[model samples]
Target: MKDFPAQYDLQDEDVLYFPHIPKTAGMTFRTILEDQFHNDDVCPATLNAQLKDYSQADYEKYRLFRGHINYVDIPQILSHKHLLLVTVLREPVARVISHYEYIRRMPGDPHYDMVKDMTLEEFAQGMPVGRLGKNVQTYYIAKLAQFDLNHLSPDEVFDLAKKQLDRLAFVGILERFQDSLFLLSYIFGWKPIINTRRENAAKDKKSKEEIPPSTIELIKQNSLLDIDLYQYAKELFETRFAEMQRDLLTKYGAFTHPQTVKEPMSSQVTQELLERHAEQRFLNLNPDISNSLSYDFVEPLRGTGWHRRESLNDRSGYRWIGPETSATLDFPVASDEDVIIEIKTICNYATTPDVAASLTLDVNGHPVQLEILYSDRGSSVRWFRAIVPKVALDNGRVFSRLTFRVNRVVSFTEVNPLNPDPRVVGIAVNSLKIFPVHAAKTESAALSVFELKSWRDVATFLEKHLGPGDKIAAPLVFQLKLPNEVLDYQTAFLSKVDFQWLILYKGTIENLNPILFNLLIHRFSPVFADGNFVVFTRQKQLPKLSFLALHVRALYEDRIKVPIKLYIIRQLKQIKSLFVRRSKQAETD
Candidate 1:
């Protein structure tokens, strides 16, 4: 008997009812399946004989078979395409406790004496715990032990249940027994039949036998894995049930018993059915358009400035603007014409004396006249804007570079300063806009800008765009250089960027290691000169300058970073002063 592999050998027409937990209801469900489908003249002897054979088998051996069926080892009896596997999941703890009580009360069982006399706590403690072990304790503990025991975590079990449901065709919650039965019947193309047993028949059992609060809490804590599984199942059931109800209502005003006196189909109902058929026909006729018209950001930096240049000098200072910068700007065209160049210096420091300086722009041994458009000095820093016109260039379609020569050196005393790192003054051209006037027709094109949201969003967005098999190239715009830690946490999801940055910065400060955060704040601080001009560059393009100006108000309303808000508000006040000074200066000029 042990060597012989038992086979149900169900035909295509026959329904196979595999119940994991056997009880009177299980038996009755099986009987109903046989009675409803098995026509007397067609195949009466076949099913009867199978039932008798199953009954004659040893109960212990059959129980083992039943246990193995629920596991992954079950033979794939139903073809993958045809099979519609269904299961009913009870609350694990309750199921285990109920099973323990039933087994303990059984007549003449070997473990009956031991279990009957012992408390549940003692029996549970004595059992060899974990998955594949029998329920000797409360249901919750037994479930935990069975799936993970000491090895796997509760979260893992929850994940596993989700995976299992995804792998299988159907799963049903025992709490919604009738609804589950209806779904099962619909899928199998059978008439719905409810099994009447002690549990199902006893409608007031829930009110009568209220589970203890302590037991429920234990179940909730111990079977956290199952709680997640139950929530997911419940959500799926609700969504699908709602859709089913809508379909039924649309087809037949309201769903009624099929056996009841049939109402004549209305003309309106027939028209609705025809309309549905026509819609489906239209859908079938049209080719799916989603695949086309989808736009993706493509890599545009190939053979561009981002490519590594072997001969380029990696100097760390206020280096002279050379051929590389000129090459990037597509500057100084042919026909011996001079080009005008402008430079803007933005500084943020208080108590810094304002200084005046002269700068010269030269192209191919030709001098150009320079003019100061704007100049402001403050306690912290000074901002200067100078423009040079009509620099000479070489003949006929050759690109010539314009170089700036500083004549007078201006120095300022850094006093009452925030003492941001890299006190060494340097110049950064944030952007260059070129307007070409071809005779009377003038055209303008500006460089594309890429703004990072939070450091995290940048990382994740980059990973998805840059990952293998993805064709996205780095944005042609300027890139922000961030710390390695900032990049690490933000590389997976867009939504977590700001949160990750905040958490990392907060953690660093809380742990008394403020060096990194402080360094970042100082380097990225807003630069304002004498409460006149505010100038700053961000790694990402900000959405609205006004929002940044109202930083404090926005932070309270929109809940942005405190440091960021402070910086914006301080900058805005200085910018207002700068606007007033500029208006006065223009009038004098």
Candidate 2:
């Protein structure tokens, strides 16, 4: 295997795709490779299976029968014939998150909820020993340890990744998945799949409540190792990607498609006539004729005002642009009247902060009121919150331009903040929408409803809600909805429809969810009710949610709710006192 690169044009040989196990990267790599070498003189085999299997006499004969064999091995498999040894490495935080998600969805696994009770460190340590399960945690631990990060320091993960690259014809990063796929295809003489979609993509459900910050911090600290690996892999892949692009341009001479004959057919020509003749081709072979244009064809067109052609700028009208109309507002606040304005901010950064927006209100056409409100931020590129005020925007003099300014400065600098420099100050009158607040009748009504039953129920609910024109919120809508007492349980009965909906929404492996976003990752087939829509999960086989519930119970001793404990304790005391009084009255009688 070491000498394989010497005989073959390593650049032209089939790729040895080795995505670290448990990373959805493998699934993507496999799918792309399958598409690329659909009929090439190369055979693809999984490294998940031991090399001993291929070394057997029968395996050798089988390869001889097939005419070509390319074995994909992890950790040590390297050869000159291997055009590329690509592995997608995710951030340690992301990897662990994915691992947790994987374990959560395992069938008949009772220890899944145990993750909630243990620290990430304890979880990582227990992973290698299969405390969760011999089948689930052990496999992930082996895959994670394959890089030898355990023996080396955190910084060494990068070095190990670099060393792995030294053995590879090319290395691809998981972060820039499409770019990596293009690079792999170019390097390995493989045809890229034009429109491959993810195999199993999870649906985006809106969650009203936010996860605790400590949990997020724990995840980050635990996945520090992966973070190192990701940084290294990203840097390596970017460098390689640029080099590969340069090499392709230099070798292929600007990368254009060969010209094709476009003969105009008469409008009267019948469809039957075109299909009847085998020699006649209807569609142009060069679908991307625009991209492959020569300098001669493009240069003259630019000066002739022909740049306005739709093909030249395909993305011209793709975005929404607000109308140029503007509106002005004037407000006067009395000494007793305090004005309040609500603003929403989009947090597109790595760290969530208590961001505050500043406002400049003008009284008598002079700057007067300057106020700020602390806003909670979330981790996604888009974060929104409604600001409620104890006072209204009524001020003095009946009319003055009120300007709202945003303090662009972020609180934390260690991690990337979504909006490093905010543009709008205080509150923009246009952005603010005023609404009167109504007091809730009861505390229970204020809480968001989350019912956890079985995967079946979840799936059914999803199919019904999701349709052609509906929009779902992100950070996921579904909560495990564990019983309050068993907050630590990994396994819980998921509504069947919810499970089915998740499977259908999340497509193939090609479009796997980002590790940070996915809470559960399992392989299963998706079934459709209307015979049109489909749903599936990561599990290959469908297991009953009840069987999985046993594991849920084991992992979480009782379900937990944020306010349930306090409410229940108070109610219990009231019941006890009532019983005591009733007994005293009975004794007196």
Candidate 3:
């Protein structure tokens, strides 16, 4: 493609060349790719004459050079920059049909007048559109090898096309459009600003099934070489896509295990504040602000998997995700900081416990931790909170994808026999909000359950936490079992806390509970104080523990004005038994 080195060479190849073959969804690709660069950085070269307006200097300035330009003409047009080529192809017969329909709809196409009165059959048989009417996808690829198709045999032409197709940066299939965009992001390291709008669709075009079999056959006869080329491209696309998926799944682990979203940011007042402060971060689906956001952050990319926005009672807008296992949102991060993402959704179809739907979120191939902040199964509404740590985000990217995969999808018909709606639904998403988790270093504290592994770790912590006069308030030590991965993100979340953080260890309850209780009181002594306390034990003891009484006492003491939250880890049976025995003994005492 572009006569570059065998390997993808970026030293001189600063430009991305997209050859827009007609009716292959190339315009959509152009729209998305152009968003990755500045407006002036994209060449205005849709035709040979448009190429004359730009000098070599002008070509060098543009990062993306795309248009309905011929493959052979690209090298001379973009002579200054070596190119990385990308294109999309559709099924040959379908593309031919779309081409004819598009010509009939658009008055601007060169063959529009000629094709205005032509029937689908007449267009298929007449083949008046020259190279584009027959095996156009192959025609583009085959031209890369030889300028003159007149010299090559039919098999020779097909073989040449296949060889060049292997060398291009990417070739997307229009049928698998969403997957193609997802793969494009991964392969090119682009955070896609996904626009799902299909530009220039041929309105009122009949479905392929409606076309007569003889007419379809006629189109197929002319597209034989394109069909072969498309098959090869399809197989190649699948192989490459599979390899990408395996690499990602292997690296990120299976999404079968779901971590609940812990900090759901759904309070109307807080949401309003965030919207007022950083309006760009809020994407209100009711108003459909995805397209209006300046940076275009956190918008749904694949339009196929989602139903149109609909209102339910007082809720003005919510969209149902279905038919696909995953729904992807574009997330553009401004820096390498942790981000808080909140989504309001309803899993209505998953009415029964056996059919409960669980969701997992991932960013740039790394899974983030999620916890449910609020849920009312009776109302069928749940608020999900996800903390995408800096480690998972690619800072300063045009956008990173936030992909949500559900464990199962249930159809309305499957849920109830009388229901006629058979669409397999994932979740009904109401709204999505994303903002950076700011680290307010001035107002912060560190409440560690266990001592860090070494002095080096302690030093690292001190370097991150301590300012000029700050002292490590004699390590309020206790032991709690938690995965180090969980510890890392959780503590990062707590690093900038202005409120009290009380850590409880169930194993040494008798020895530590009094001390923790007293500390909790002291921390809550301020007239207006609010905080979060975490219980890290091996079991589900929060419900049965004597410490529950102490926690209740702290709230009733009239010394605290704000709410205190309790976050507990899930329990093991053995730990539960031990905590139960301890509670009984404490009661007896």
Candidate 4:
């Protein structure tokens, strides 16, 4: 099977419908859903209340439907098309205990106070009278056959739940989660989801052994229907899993699990190459950690503006903010202080002379007064500076959003009749930096800056700056022109050195290819600890490091620096000499 772009667009054109029952490892499964489908195609109805306003057209538009929804509760529009129903089931008694813990821990839940004072047994016994009791899984699944849960008998509900399991495209057992993930991947033609972190699990939750036996018995008694349903689901999962394993062997000629499939060596080399390129281009840009937090227009942490990355040349790129746009940058602050925000903007679309664009700046929802730092009409570049008061930043957040509202916007078509570009553009931002007013003054004294223009310059810079224990943590928040050859050589040189590398790239880490990046990270595991190299991204799946050293010889190729190549050769010769000595000693013995 090959990777299907979207499951909805498959030959059968089936919708991937997941009726998520709470506390059944569905949150972890959601990571896969998000990765597999586009955000616009996934339904936002997590609860039934969210689904109340959705019309048939709304229901039909989404390719994937998930969240805390019951199958029967889904709109009738879904019934007209081919549907691939899937769900995960946890062990009944365990599920009940987990749900009870979840409710007690989460103050946001409406039932939080209701079960706060009750003992585990009391909670189970008392709650069993309603729809969301010990048998909630059965309650959700049985409703598929008969929507009216009040009328269905316990036996009838259990039987219907089993029938629903028989009809499901796949049934996942939460205990065998990894196996379930692999099975689903093979079945659905998805890239294998590896190292998914569990989400939404209750804090300080107890194991089955921690609970009193009486409480366990009480939960078991209440969850009789769910226990039976879970057993059936487990059986179904096992049969399907075995069949899938056989199919995988028959198709691919081996047991193809995510753990078994190795990531390519080229991917690792490529990641190092890209990260190095970012580092060399922006090294020594940040004067100090406390000075400023910069948000490049190409990659703001969070914002409202969206179009596409615009590049004037290979050396520089920026994004156009429409009428209004906001860029958020986060930095640590120990005390309250006023900060200066610098915006480098260009208004080439300005129709009026002397007035390129009128921008109103706001910091953390508070209006700020802007001062014209400098304006150059010849280059269409304007530098606007503003001071955000300490009161505005005292909102108990480490980060502040700087919003820009422009008075005028002109499309390319509006600017020129022959121009086919229809993009509505306001002022284009090259850099957005926020720093404490005091730190801005002290930036010149913080660190020695360098402008390494070539491979020799980079080598000299590294030799001068990097010591035995020196940590080269380059925060790429500003733009600097550096040659492409130096970027590659700098990366290769750093790989040969005895220094800590904490290179940070502020842009979208999601834009980088995952397989390559993960492989690169795994390569660093030998020199550093588990978390030494960290790049903040929007994904929750942690990269699993492999122990494979198959790429050692690959690193000895032409890409490596000359000195490093010589060092490797010398090390290899020493290893050979040691072996020869050992052989001679054995002969003497």
Candidate 5:
């Protein structure tokens, strides 16, 4: 699909409409919603034939409407304006193959007898150009947007399909089942579940190697629209997931410095009391064993944030939080001297390093902070420690409720193909322990800082902050040699929300002109400026736009340092603004 830049705001009160595109995990989801949740307010339909039979009362009676319903006709049946549409999309080729296998397995179906002997290749070639077979997903999406597909071209259909998808509350990935379910949980405030079985699962599914190249190509050629649509959905999912993740990080991710609250033992102790503990070699060999416990070593995963086990494994009862999932532990905090929890986690990022998961320590039902886990290069063990403020504990309580949620997990089977393991193994946390930091008093107030000196440092810093959306102008170095020499001129660049660097260079107002500067072979022409404090405005109709408007300021010119510092500060501010805007945009969208 040609990129649809606009996104629709998925609002509350919109009808939860699930258009069950056949073979795209629809059966599995239906079983869970219908079989498992018998009391849920739902209007159900498993096949296309049932859609035409729905009445106005059917729409008004249920909160959830599930079917292999035509997207275009749902509105007409509903007699409503808003719909919180949701669906799962699969790989185009895999979906086609699954559709073929499912039809063959259905003995009661009318087409079953005729297609029992048909080869996958034959089926791919013979499947019609309508909503049931080739490019079926895209057809339904297009039909929903335009009410009919006959008037539009193939590319137009793709465009409309994407436009409709953007408005959806959630578009789940069939492969990223756990993660998708978590997104649904996060978006809808549903109790996220992980213990469900895969109902109506397909068996002996053929791999790409087993499918002939011609048959695969035939499917791909006919359903190119589905491929593009799937790709767009994937990107949208990642963006939305990342945005939600950042929120979780903000909500639960906290890093607290040493005692802002008055410490219980840091007060003055009387000389008489001190004499009572004097002179003995106080050899407490097994120190406070009662207070300290490790998650991996002894505690089974059976507490607050822990999900029930699906099938027992050697994993010591740990559940697969392949999505945004949480686990809770109760830690003893006797006297609140200082609560230190050390978490031992092992994860293999050999697969999707970019697709990392975040862990947030939630204390007393409040999210304290989140920590992101990413591999430096390969799979490895990570050690995380959360220091709970004594204030986190309830009045005179010995135990505190600690919940750990792996806020975000993204899986990419296509891009990196680097991680081939099927199950989205985020992080297998082995142990969580509560112990005193023996040197708690020695904890410093100052945070560790990285000082950038050389080009390499600058490069690293820039890489950490800036992405492709940003643009930087050279520092506006104006060494105005006045009639009388005076370095009294002051200058500082103010930060803007967009990723922009207004690098001002040496020149007077009248002498200003647009000079072309190239970055990675892309040409950028600086906006014409009159003088210092000149209002640089882009007319509402400028074709090309970049965030490079800057004010000229000439301070003591070192040539080596000032410009770089200015650029760095400008870039940093821009990055922060970009994140903020993105966060707000995500909430609305």
Candidate 6:
């Protein structure tokens, strides 16, 4: 169960499969694999000769099989060989553009010659345009599900591709190169190096403005399927990466590294390479400036020890307590710290004070001071806040259980003569918030997502305040809620912010991805987790961004806010489609 040999640990005889979808940073991943598995062992796999065609001994000898082949061409020996499936995905528009630019430079191919002198607009408007970058990524993955492209509708093919992606052991995002590398290393226990040097990246790439609007519109129009698939891939990438990070915490413990590692200067090999690379990637990503969100945003469903007693069967109905009915709540403390325990509850008693009952609240078996609730307030629901000293907590180890004993229930009918039944009901507990006393300050600064600029603003802030070696608290508490009110500060993962920012700001790849990786390590890690920030964004405005909004981040919207993430992704796709549709309509006119 140790984190080193992950739950998906590779066997000695395991076979790693890489469906090298073109322009997905596959060459970079392939290079990393070759270094780890020995160049001789990492063999090129092709459609002409699959694993089934190779002898058993040959298959056993080659640990890593990768090449640009049809997706469905996996060797039939998959059932017998332990297969570790992995791939990378890019933004559809960017990938398509990159593909065109790459092929546009080639002199040998007839297709390349056709587009060599012609502009992007000419290529788009040309007859038989389907041969170019239309749904190339989708076609690659869809082929895995149905060998014949005609077998399924485009939507059906995309759904199958996504369904199959969920089963993949790892799917890294090309836009999120460094973070993805860290995750792949963590997942497969490989020594991953940051290789920003892309293969087939044309020296003379066309600027976004240089490409005609008609061509750009056509690219979007033709690649809607790829756009959807890319989003799904992004979601999957972040999901598995979270699992890998959890494994790191389980095996390596928190904050084993507590400093911003500078990128290595012309170094040939690793360790420092990883540290520097990671540090550089995280450079611009500081969450503090984006908002005053604290660490409380994380909700630890497990290990933190907050639980509702299943034995009492309180889940099915309200925690109804008669005159003597008692209820207990338990919360775990990861580290001994002064915390204000907040409880939100709704009493069955409406506006009537017929329930003349006060429940005693005890923490760690001892009664604590809490404000008395009066039904006379006219509000049926109220929040009770109690400050508890750190020493008073039961925390003595990694996590100590803090028990809450509630009893002394008083019923309403006792005081109201007109009350029907005399039975008393205390409260139906709605939610609980156990946070450090100092976190009270972050509550007042619950800024809307609209108030914040780019995610870089948040990263820049976290880098200074919560950055590495700063002993504030492990996993700080923050209050981050999305405008949609679905993904609270806790459940949503935040690391993708750094990745998104990396893609947003362009320069030498050296400064962007590496420094963001640094931010991830120094500021974001010891594993920065929890629902700590709330993003208040309108559901209707999800797709549209300000002139300054990052289109790349918009493509992979999961890192922003949950609940409305789908809304944003859909909105972007819709807007793109509409823009294209209108442009075509104009051209026809």
Best TM-score among the predictions, by candidate number:
3
| 238-258 per-residue lDDT for model 5 (tens digits) | 776566455443432332222
Local lDDT at 485 for model 6: 17
- Residue-wise C-alpha lDDT for candidate 2, range 425-516, written one tens digit per residue: 21112123222323111211111322323334544555454544322221122222211111111112232222322322221111122321
Candidate 3 structure quality by residue, lDDT tens digits, 554-585: 53342322222222223355678899999999
Q: How close is every model to the real structure, measured as TM-score?
A: 0.31, 0.33, 0.46, 0.45, 0.43, 0.40
Ranking by TM-score: 3, 4, 5, 6, 2, 1
In TM-score terms, candidate 2 sits at 0.33
RMSD of each: 31.4, 27.4, 18.9, 26.1, 27.6, 29.2
User: 2 or 6, which is superior by lDDT?
Assistant: 6
Model 3 deviation from native, Cα RMSD in Å: 18.9
Ten-residue stretch with the least lDDT total in model 3: 440-449
Worst 10 residues of 5 by lDDT: 477-486
Off by over 4 Å in 5: 1-13, 31-40, 51-53, 255-589
User: How would the candidate models be sorted by lDDT, starting from the highest?
Assistant: 4, 3, 5, 6, 2, 1
Provide the global lDDT of candidate 1 against the true structure: 0.33
In angstroms, give how far residue 94 of model 6 lies from its true place.
1.3
Instruction: Candidate 3: count the clashes.
Output: 7
TM-score computed on alpha carbons, candidate 1 = 0.31
> What clash pairs does model 3 have?
191-399, 260-370, 260-371, 261-370, 261-371, 261-372, 262-371
lDDT of 4 at 581: 100
- After superposition, the stretches of candidate 4 with alpha carbons farther than 4 Å from their true spots are 1-9, 254-589
Off by over 4 Å in 6: 1-7, 45-61, 77-79, 113-131, 246-589
Q: Is candidate 1 or candidate 6 better by TM-score?
A: 6
